[model samples]
Target: MESGPAIFAGAAFTLFGAALLLWTGVRARQGEPVALGVAPRAAVALTTLFGACFLLLGIWCFGRL
Candidate 1:
């Protein structure tokens, strides 16, 4: 497998995931309003889960590289 593209993709995923996680953390810390329909806790949980998935995917891709 070509490590170049994989590494780039992994870095992108990691950065995006980190950004989402940071945003969620800031929102929670600031007691900001969450999106409609979902409860505050659920929203945070979902965001965290999504961010974790992305982070893990990125790590796996980086490992491949």
Candidate 2:
């Protein structure tokens, strides 16, 4: 409920998503197949969507400040 906690949570989520996406990028470049038990292309798509969602959620949290 506090601003500080909210900001921390948002930052954590944003960082996690960014890291996940970055890993995906590396894997794709290496031509590795399957991520999270799925196809490479699907993995990329899911990670992209989840990463965007994380960014949006973080922005929403920050906006409350």
lDDT of 2: 0.79
Top lDDT: which candidate number?
A: 1
What are the models' TM-scores? 0.89, 0.79
Report per-prediction Cα RMSD to one decimal.
1.4, 1.8
Superposed by TM-score, candidate 1 places the C-alpha of residue 9 at a distance from the truth, in angstroms, of: 1.0
Q: How well does candidate 2 score on lDDT at residue 58?
A: 78
Please state the error at residue 45 of candidate 1 in Å.
0.4
Instruction: Write candidate 2's Cα lDDT for 1-65 as tens digits.
Output: 49898889788877877777777788888988637678778888888889778877877777877
What lDDT would each prediction earn against the true structure? 0.90, 0.79
For model 2, the stretches where C-alpha displacement exceeds 4 angstroms are 34-36
Worst ten in a row by lDDT for model 2: 32-41
